[model samples]
Target chain A: MNNKYNIFLLATIFTLCIFVLQSVEAESESVYEIRNNQIMEPLVEGLPDPMNGREIVISRIGNCLACHKISSIDESFQGNIGPSLDGVGERYKEGELRLRLVNPYYLNPESLMPSFFQNKNLVRVEKKYSGKTILTARQIEDVISWLLTLK
Target chain B: MKFFLSLLLFSLINSVAGRTENIKGINDNLYDRPYSIGELKSGRNFLQKETLEMELDDFDNPGMIWVERGKELFNSVLEKNNLSCNQCHNTNKNSLIGAPSNFPKLNKDNISLINMEQQINICIVDYMEARPYPLESRELLSLSAYIAYKSKGLPMDIKIDSSNEKFFKRGKELYFERIGQMNLACNQCHNHLEGKYLRAEQISQGHINGYPSYMMRWGVVASVHRRFQFCNEQARAEPLEIGHPDYNALQLYIAWRGSGLLFESPSIRR
Candidate 1:
């Protein structure tokens, strides 16, 4: 009788473990929902910070300044490959900017801008950066907020 | 304060002297030139004054060390046949000078492409009865530097004939195809913005006339393939192994693209 009872207990524990593991994985993977041409929700817990976003725009990690010129910024040698970011806040809506930051390829098939948040479908990514997004969900949100203030 | 002032002065002087827009390609009438001949500038023109000055002086150039080492290896005789590269190649009748200009040519098979380093290894294995030096090894780079040094002033003249036309087309295609997370193609920065600054470094016209060039960052002479690997990594892409056939194809294309530029191998780069 005791042996049978112990077997039942083991089965119950195994089932519980599986359920917990799956829920945890789901929570981590759950990011944002995309609507037509927009990511209609914020991705993380904290409020977006424009100051941090500005840092990322010029930083090596984001390197937006490498291809996009911002005449408002005092830094020299801004690139001219992409459209200038000046008056961008006036040009784009909040959700629209968010979508572009998340994945510009959705809008333009041949967009040179990197998908700052999406990691899948990238080819030949360096081993160090494999399975990692260029920018975090929070960082993307911050960049969106900062870009909205560009006007 | 004094150091800052001096730096300010130096940059001002550099800006005036280091303008790259005026520099022109060697040939004004290159056949089927991609960019205007007047707009084509050698990578050397984009360098800072200090680096340029260092490259101009043979004694001061660090790449010369590899050339010297290669000379020693070229003259050294093997015990079995009592043979040295000097015995065959150094003779006035069969001098190797101006040979590197037309290299990365088709091998005897007429299918496989062989660059300078591979050709050296082939001679070592086939004739000298010795094991080949590993790719990117010090010995191989040294030999390449020496060979390239011999053709220092000669124009690059890679011939992409009917036999090699397929490979040339493949190379050109790869040059324009976007790869990596950065979604960058060679044509994006190298072809479009040769004189523009990407951060502190000025972009060059993506030429391969300086293979086996001395890179200050590595403090060693590097092959064109190794430089390509560096470029791939910078784009956050997985780099292919050195000596890959694809890289050989790219080298052929780049060599042909800048066909009239002088072979400035063992040149300094930062």
Candidate 2:
């Protein structure tokens, strides 16, 4: 009985370790895609990228919720500064979004929307995050993928 | 074993029930009062019920940690003037009632608008004959929290006379001016949709009575200017330094907007 219990305990520990490791991998894994037409190429990891995009829509990461409202996220609070993104898919082409995602300033110099992928020309980035893009290329693509499904 | 499990379950139920009862009691009068311009509800009122409880519990309130640190620093002697804050001001906090609310007004000299943190540094430089504490220094923040802590519950009484009129006007412009790559003005989030939520966080009027308040996200207390810098940065504008004149002017304006709200110094925020 004691030996059986020891085996059971070892199995549980191994399973727990794997579960934690997988979550960490899920959080950090993103592939950089080389896009021909985007204003700036995004880090594109094709691995279940849509879920990543949905999170970015709702999260402080993309801060999309700060300006645009998305309907399905089940989060009760959303802002109205930008247009509601419920039908964003029907409105703009993927190429247009790619431009906006990379840097909205290219399309409209006066636009207040932040560049999700570009880093170099940003103003007032905190010192520790100076060179960092708000969202990785993969993250931008994930957000775009999710935004596309909104229509 | 069965008895222990049952007791544990019973206690948990009782505690949860007790907490809800306490919340009901507290929430009853928080935002039910008459509203007026410059007479807005507190950020505390907008807090989620659970967070409000965390702030109300003095022993459990995280901001009290900063207040305690400030208290300690208040009694400690300065290296330059051999004078501690308690040497001049009342060591007993109650004596400072209604004092901090009068700030961001003209100083005795009527030269520049000064907030609580600036007043602390001004005292250090003018009276202690010591160098002003560097802006946003932990020592300075602690003292500011302590002094302002004394004035908790005092209605804001900032004066907007000739001495501070220009600063107040400039600060008002800054509040409404759109900046940052995000092109957000302070009024867009705070004035327009204060009840609305952003990223699940409720928008408050962006008042500053709570500084050097503790932010759970930062896990540290921050000065008012630090919060301003964070807001500017989030708006994608270049955040000015902690003591920039623009931020100071903004602070003055915000303080005036929260004119009648009781102080909640070292208040907790998400």
Candidate 3:
């Protein structure tokens, strides 16, 4: 009788431990997981490498380098406008960086940075640039990938 | 332990729901009205005409007063510098169109440029060997107003190249970003509520055209930078100092944003 009671108590404790562990994992996964109702889409694949990403950043086509600074290149360029991006990779994970590149204001709604992937239907702009994404999904992914390389 | 855990989870969910509800409330209160570009353009035209007529109504236009003071300062040759503004640019006022508009322009001598206000202060400190007037002081306001008055009606043409792209982008970011205890973005008010009203007065696009305007509220002329500082304060956000590079970038963006609107310096505003 004593042995049976001990076994029963051990089984209950084990089940409870498993439940708690699973809940914690789920909570963490939710942070990185792309939800259906989210304003912006998550990066899936087909992202460009860091070098090409750098090209896109510096180009008027991307314009990320316009306000931010990355120490990888020593081109005679420096802007006092935005924060330096020397070790952004170390500061944030790939998923967080992806979210920021897509729309920095999502995390900090007060961010001056424009939402790169904001749906056009929601955003109002001049007729000429209306209904256009500021950056393509692929470009956004590439930028995120590049940002992750700052470490 | 289980009860405590359940309580923690419940509180977390409640807090998150509360935050979402608050955000929704703010969003609903913000930008409840639509804005039209055509109406904005018309308003700009009306204000410009009214300002031009105002020049005739009062001999004591603040802009004119500043211009007269600037004229005196320009002509007065100091002991250290034998040169006066007359020595370089001559006394022809007509030749000075759009000159002040182009400033905070690049100065060729220092390989670094300064704004009109900075230039005046530099002259006072270095050339005239006089004590530099504090920024926002009557002396500085008068000089900037005088310069802006001279450059009135000239379309603003600030350049943004690779060199300045960073600054431009920063300015753009700042403009759109939300700030303050109210968590209101500039676009939330200026862009979204362009024609709406917080009170009796219409919120006119918050355009920068009539900057350095004579505010009826203040009963004094205020610079664009000063106005920005005021807005920040009103929003309950920390205001950046005048002549700060971030503010300069913001100034550049505001000027560019109000590109279509005609210049109306020293104009009266409520």
Candidate 4:
């Protein structure tokens, strides 16, 4: 019975290691593909939540308000660095918006906007944040969904 | 091969076009100020009314405590060399009045830059034969505060001559180069959006004239380098350690940018 218990424990540990490795691989995997100036695929499985996107835009993780102004948001002291996001929903299609969020540099090399979903090619990132994208794929989708409602 | 050659030619033209656009207002002269005269504003002008009042009233200002400590340190004799800062610097021929505004000056090596804090350390280690104070230490802050206090009301006079031109150029580049997850450059907020609100606080024209100012958040007398580290962290960038060469170079550039602003060390800042 003791020998059987030992085999059972070994099997459980092996299963746990596999689960952890798979999760890490999922995190490192690129979620969206860029085609020219657009990304014609969704980044994650679930439907995007506009409400969650709004919170991220205002919060520090997204910090969109630090440079961009959103008219629908009631927060005071919104920045004016970027153009107002009032009619951004009407301005571009879903794929174009996805490309801009993933990598604004594709359109304008000198654009001051940070690539929220791209981790490579960044310089001087804080150590704790070196390998991390500013936002997760789901978070980027959420932000885009909320931005789409600005019209 | 034809496609490759055409691609290279197109990139060459694009690169040339990009540089001309960026170099619009900048001049070849290192002495040329980024902002024209009369356009510059001291960081003091951005302070809230209550904080401004506190700065104006010496009795109410908490930074005075550090300045007072600095004065004591400046006058105290070192056992190692039987000397004090006041003995050499306060002499009739070498009085340090108006001296604070002239750093980060060229060091004795004449290649690298050294700020008021580093200068103080040099004096202790080289002249007074004493162990140098650690960077951002209370004693070091106090000494710098005392020296800067002597230069109060004098307009800053940073020199960007042949001796320190390279450092000044590096500093200017640093001020404009975007960094971190935020991809923010110093010129974006401080230069373009001065007096604009980020959240609630008004963005000041980034100036070092009021450092080593008393910071309300930390409740301590902070050095300019310490403040730079905080700004880096706020932009989600990695902060270099205190007294890093890059920080000194950035300091030199910022001091030059605000060259005419009056020095106000240990000034109250929130």
* The candidate that achieves the highest lDDT relative to the unseen native structure: 4
- For model 1, the local distance difference test gives 0.79
Global lDDT of each candidate: 0.79, 0.70, 0.60, 0.81
* Model 3 lDDT at residue B4: 57
- Better model by DockQ: candidate 2 vs candidate 4: 4
Q: State the lDDT of candidate 1 residue by residue for A69-142, as single tens digits.
A: 99889988787767899999999899889878875755765566777875545567888887778888878888
The deviation in Å at residue B252 for candidate 2 is 0.4
Q: Please give the ranking of all candidate structures by lDDT, highest first, separated by commas.
A: 4, 1, 2, 3
TM-scores of the candidates are 0.80, 0.64, 0.52, 0.84
Interface RMSD of each: 17.2, 18.9, 14.2, 5.9
lDDT, candidate 2, equals: 0.70
Looking at model 2, the pairs that clash are: A31-A44, A31-A45, A33-A44, A42-A137, A43-A137, A43-A138, A53-A142, B180-B237
Q: Which residue pairs show collisions in model 3?
A: A112-B173, B104-B115
Worst 10 residues of 1 chain A by lDDT: A25-34
Look at candidate 4 and give me any clashing residue pairs. none
Ranking by DockQ: 4, 1, 2, 3
Candidate 3 per-residue lDDT over residues B1-270, each given as its tens digit: 566555754654454334333432234422122333344442343344555566545475555666577667666675566766556555554356676556555445634446667777886777667778788777677767766776677766666666656665666667765554333456656664444433234455676666667765787777777888777765445677787766777776666656545666766766
DockQ of predicted candidate 3? 0.02
- Tens-place lDDT digits, model 2, residues A20-115: 996654344321222343434344445537888888778777878876787877777677656788888889777667777764544554345665
Sorted into a CAPRI-style docking class, model 3 comes out as incorrect
Clashing pairs in 1: none
Off by over 4 Å in 4: A1-38, A71-77, A106-109, B1-32
